[model samples]
Target chain A: MTVIKPKIAVYKFTSCDGCQLAFLNLGNDLLKLTDAVDIIHFAELGMVNPNAKVDIAFIEGSIATPHDLERIKNIRAKAKFLITIGACATAGGIQALRNFADTAEWVAAIYPKPETISYLATSTPISTHVTVDLELWGCPVNGEQILTAIKTLLLKVKPAIKRDSVCLECKRSGNVCVMVTKNIPCMGPVTQTGCGALCPSVGRDCYGCYGPSENPNTDSLSKQFQQQGCSRETIQRRFLFINNQAPAFLKAGMKK
Target chain B: MSMKMEFNNQEYYFLPHVKINALLDYLHHQGFSCIGPQIKQDAIVYEELHDSEQLPWGLRDYQMPGQYRLEENNVKRAFSWANGPQAIKPQLFKPKESLWRVARDSHGKLTFKNVTHEMKPIALFGVRSCDVAGMLIQDKAFLTEPFVDKHYQARRENVFVIAVNCGYSSNNCFCVSTNTGPQVKAGYDIALTEIDDGFVVTVGSAAGEALINKISLKHATDEMQQAMQREINNAATMQSKAMPFDNTRVVRDLLMNNLDHPQWDDVAARCLSCGNCTSVCPTCFCSSETETPALDRIESEHSREWDSCFTEGHSYIHGKVIRDDTKSRYKQWLTHKLATWWDQFDTSGCVGCGRCVTWCPVGIDITAEVAAIAKPAVDDSASE
Candidate 1:
């Protein structure tokens, strides 16, 4: 009997390529993943097929350009399962800060010839352009999470991604609250728990790198930050940073 | 002379501040790991203690709503701080633990194996009265008839508690209102009240008496006893926060009657629903289970982790969430913790350690919330 491996592809759009590094960081586990699936296209790893029909497609980055808008739809059409990896593809990432700003003004300020730049007015998540089967949220999606998602998908099971706040993970790991102890303006209470409570564990405030958690009460957190002596601009900037385009964060960040 | 004297639970002795090392050393010699409070990550937390030197000596903690700061007072007293984020709950009811594993053989026979952890007997030193109360409440939940948690039982059975009477109380503390703290009442093998020079130790169990017999302790003089009582009384007076009503029945009735009270909406608006309150709550005992299947799909490990009502997953029923909004989730948590817990376990879930108030990032005080809801109704009725 012959066994046919699942064809897999990792695609990039407008990203920092940090999410792609998560796969490489898998190290020896990457070899195990390769044995389980056929890597038809992963341009960063030197396999260069832009258009390939695959069982699973891992998308990194956002749909920033007119070309990205069309490419995502094409990728969606080809992929049996479309999984958005990292903050960029899932929630429009740090680049989505452009969504809140004047794109024309910034382009004109940066470029000598502004008309040469061909980009959309707003940077949007992959889900904005195409139907996303699953979303793995993080600044750079955790390698273990990506591996687990793949393994579960291979077994025809849905991946169980936790949608709890970073505070939960922080508590479980026995880490003291940076916000409570040091009066630091941390986003752990409202941010998702994918980074294993990384920032707060290291005595730094979480900057919401994993996006807004389930039912994130950003208004309450913002009020808390304000009470902790954070300025209006600082509070806005905290919410509007990495996952600025996320609906809950966008609404909160835009608040006066 | 150090001799095995017939000591009862009521007997009090003085163990000098310098002789605390002897107590820790004795526990270690008895094949028990001594766990005590220490300064970790800017907060006082319970960690493994090898000697009395590991204790948070002279470190006074200032705890307010949404704030906790530790400062050196240059004193020599251990267990001077009120409490930390956790009690002894995590020691038995772990944050995350594997329950069991299942494997399938080549012949398709599935074998199930229980995943039992090898835990050493723990001597929990420097525990607080509220924490002791919290443990008893947890005992009612986990160790009661017909529904005994075997995992919790395994760890709890081999445990020894060395509780401490709170010499000082933080700003958020209201154990006096809850009638649970400032003085060690019960549920301890040995209870210690820290005086300026030494601890007025009261043995509460045979094991505690046996341990005390091994150490040379001076008979607690009336002066030392008076000093211990004075410190405990001072701790009670230090607390500004208090429950609106001391009666749990009245509090429970007020909450149950006012399920749709506007205060719920007001609190929900301010509450992040981050589960921080529940996480810091020593008596909150909700856990969720997950099945992790191997890549081969032949084996799986079942695990349970601490969960909170704040999450959408907690109220998840068939195909939909019961508590879909923050209002409903917050209502569920507060109601269950303060009101309905009595129905389930014949006691209030809160031990009034004020951990929830101090640890909440947004500083949502449970006592204040209860007061907000209850005080209005009482005022209106009184006016009538």
Candidate 2:
């Protein structure tokens, strides 16, 4: 009469461990999650069987090193569903800023012993190496979004993540348009909605932490930023900030 | 009494500025929640009104393409601004609401329940003429013969509309050209034109007459009537923007014929396709539905939220996105709003309140787009 619980694992590579905190921060929900699934390998939560075969594998961070490149491929083979969580695992995160620059120079400048480091020439998302079942995008994916994904997966259904812009959420929440009213040069028009229009709701411009939305018109948004008197560097930085390696944002940031 | 005689016998009343609260109190006593325009987060938004003092007074909104600013004016008036991003549309057709829910028990049997919220009768105060026009258009959309939306109808039937005639026009306003504003023409229980001293009220229905009769008011004098007319005329004349054509048929034909014009490419380049224009548009009624099951998989709720044609999902049918590009999506929105809307609903979707223009983050003006398509510039460079 008992049902076998789905085995879940949390893996990290070159990320800041912030997205893993999204699961830990699920306070009471974390306890309830234990009742629903078997957490076979979340190192932060003290469970550390990394090689265990799991029903679902939640991967965080970019494939920034030789070890990450090999580890992700092994994890992909072990897991039935490999879902990438946060900006790093999906779009190479803020560290992917190194992808645009000379990684050798960055390592030499930052580290006292550059030869001690064994890293890839360019930081890249996990999707670059192995197939990703789904991608939960954000600088640190929110707890609610993580829960929604797990809940939908439990029901044997695909998670319904809206691919609309942050502007839609801002309108729904009845937040005044900061870009239009205060000339804040908000990226809400091109950014995805997972952050729930967080920055604009607090009178700040969106930094596009959740990454570029579906069919984002980055060229038009760049033009808008220029019209708002934003410097070329500032406009580029806006797109290249958190989810730098995302294709649409990378193309936008690299534009002249 | 004959209809003409009854109309001739009707009297217009003047409700002084101070007596506005009394109207709110009367509506409250009648079990109707009053909602009116008030300054919130630097914009005039419709919220629950417990007192008339909450209305935006001595505040004028300066709206342009992609900009809105609230400035204090010496003139003390409540309804001086043109309109906000939202109207009475959201009040009835909610942004998101659960339609129904289904639950499964341990026995593996399922049960369904309709999730209808207990709605209170809402008395919308300070609604503009264009918004009133929007309400009528929505009524045609949601309350039509074959498939009437029960949730929308439930809220629509229990609503009281108190419209206000515009005394001033914002920079993007073109209601005069649309022939739908500057004065409250139809679709209201009561219409109020604000003068210096008070509001000159026109009762459009028996319900309006009943409410006005409860409040002791002076009959509108000839001077008061003249002042109201002057204010309305000023509003009409001050508008700087206009559609390409006054006639809806002409506009429909113009947009329908020039479907493949280069102007669409020009607009598509500037457009972010963010759905801001559709969200701000009072008449745009597209919605999308989603079903969310509880973590336990024992219960699930099906809900609908506001959707826009700008979204790629809106054009998705049978695993194929028909309008895969921004140009095609923008074309769908403009054509459907101005041209195809008439063929579907027998009325143009745009009411020309200009919320779409002002609230658009990049300021893609609908009127200007229409004008470009209607009259393309001469290709003198090619000749040279």
Candidate 3:
């Protein structure tokens, strides 16, 4: 007979909520996944806060508000294996753009009463506040990868995905490149490999929606972009867009 | 030697139509998963072939600056993959969609399962010389990375590569400059140089040599080898550099300084964060993951799929998008791949495949951009 299933929790902070939707996108795999674990808490599905102790926890989004700062620490303390999913949870997400600007001035311009709201000046990942066993990347985490990480969690093994650029996936799909024929700027050569060369297939450039890979060569690729007639602003804007919080993109984005 | 075989010097291996059909039967019986070119949705695509009829023989394809059209020609028994828009890495490396999840069910049971890698021996027929270089470059990303990808390693092992030397070069083909083309180098199990009447096939591996023996072919004379060399040399002579951007150091130094170069604002004006450039690049590999649920909702499954860098939500910090300005984000992508990647991986990330040139809507060519920045002195150097 199966013993008590391991308890699992899904948490979110600041994001487009696309990462949480990634869980809902599990489709047929959702039932199969549930058969393997116990879903103790998932606020998006109305699982509520103050979740119970469990074997694993999947946290989405980044820590932006003061309330999130305390909440992240508590979640880390309760879970035995904590994994961060999506760009927001792993690299601080697009919200990290705030790091390069005058936060007070931007806040004053937007909010009616800037003093009334209390939040962290910098939006950061769970690892920034505590420890993270695994990092599942992407702007909105891919559902299939999330499942792969969960299995690794139960088996007590390391993750299988590594730091390779999107170019690898582009080659694997046998799709003709959009950049070469169209003279377009594609991030496929430099961005990490998780998105299967999707944009190029449909005639679009990579905005770096996924974050950085391990040992990424941002400087070298940027040099190549310059060779392609890309202006300095064009190159910098690409980095500052989707994954400005990722150290690789952040360093380039905040270059000013 | 334990074995020796002889063949007639006068006879050629260009078998009759009937024998050619029979040869297909023999290859199929041996469990060869043949891959060749086929038209897909109007454009030609390379995929698996179930039989001999599926092979695009006697087909010469014409490519313009931004177009491709296939025409039947007698002199077309070579790898027409000759500077096509696509590169062949993902077939031997990464995939688009994958399942990786750990979650809990309403029944209070913990569950976790990942999609298992598959075993499929593939025969990459009619591969161009530059594609072999593309595969070698992929090794740097998937195999050489800190955590080796067992999936890629396994898939690569099952792949039997049959590379063909290109007879002609395209205007956009830059493999010669990249040291990746015209003739197949080491990575292949077999290499073929197409000549009149039949192909001059050379076996690079023992497996290829055994296949050569099986084909009942003759010993190639010294003249035949010279002709093969001549074919490759001709291809190289036809290719010339489109851009002369040799100074990579200046480009790297400029990016490293973080001096807020004014050139970036000009770039941003025409920039579209759609991600066409990165997707078609031979080396870019950034990605993101996500999860989708089952329709029943009894249990939710997690999946780690592909993501891109160009998306606004990608750089969210807590709840904020980090890259408010698109200009900086674009800069990070190009610099990392061309400049910093050398430091991280000990080699230039790009193989100069030239896919980024045609696939881009705005036609952003990396090689051209480097030449402009590497011009020695920046016009706005005094502003700093």
| lDDT winner | 2
| DockQ, candidate no. 3 | 0.07
A23-70 per-residue lDDT for model 1 (tens digits): 999998898778788999999999989888999999999999998998
lDDT of 2 at A161: 83
TM-score of chain B of each: 0.95, 0.95, 0.80
Candidate 2 structure quality by residue, lDDT tens digits, B241-351: 998787387899998898878899999999999999999898999999888777777999999988899998798899798998899999999999999999999989999
**Pairs with backbone N, CA or C atoms under 3 Å apart (clashes), candidate 1:** none
Candidate 3 lDDT over residue span B1-384, tens digit each: 001122222222222223334544445556766665565533445677665466666765555433444566765353443555544554654545465655667776868777675555667766777677667666677777576766666667667777778876665567776667778766776667766545667666656665655666666666777776787888778775443333244445656664366556655544444455565565666555544444233344544433445545456578686865557666766677666876776655566556565454344566665554544546654775
lDDT of 3 at A82: 87
DockQ of candidate model 2: 0.75
Per-model C-alpha RMSD = 3.1, 2.6, 11.3
Error of 3 at B109 (Å): 5.9
Candidate 3 accuracy as lDDT: 0.65
Task: Please provide, for model 3 over A1-256, each residue's C-alpha lDDT reduced to its tens digit, 9 standing for 90 to 100.
Answer: 8677778889878887888788889877777778878788998877875657767888888898999998888888898988888988898888878877777788999999999987788888788999998888887778878877776556556665645566546644656555543456667655776766567566677777777754355665576567678898988988887778777887765554
Point out the higher-scoring one by DockQ: 1 or 2.
Answer: 1
Q: Report per-candidate TM-score of chain A alone.
A: 0.98, 0.98, 0.94
Lowest summed lDDT window (length 10), candidate 1 chain B = B1-10
| lDDT tens readout by residue for model 1, B1-384 | 011233466777999988999999999999999998988899888989988888999889999889999999898888678888886988979999999999999999999999989889989989999988888888888988899999988888878899999889999999998999888777888889999888999987788888889997878999999999999999999889997687377789999999978899899999998999998888988998987776666788999998999998898889788898899999999889889998998888888899999998988888989988975543344653
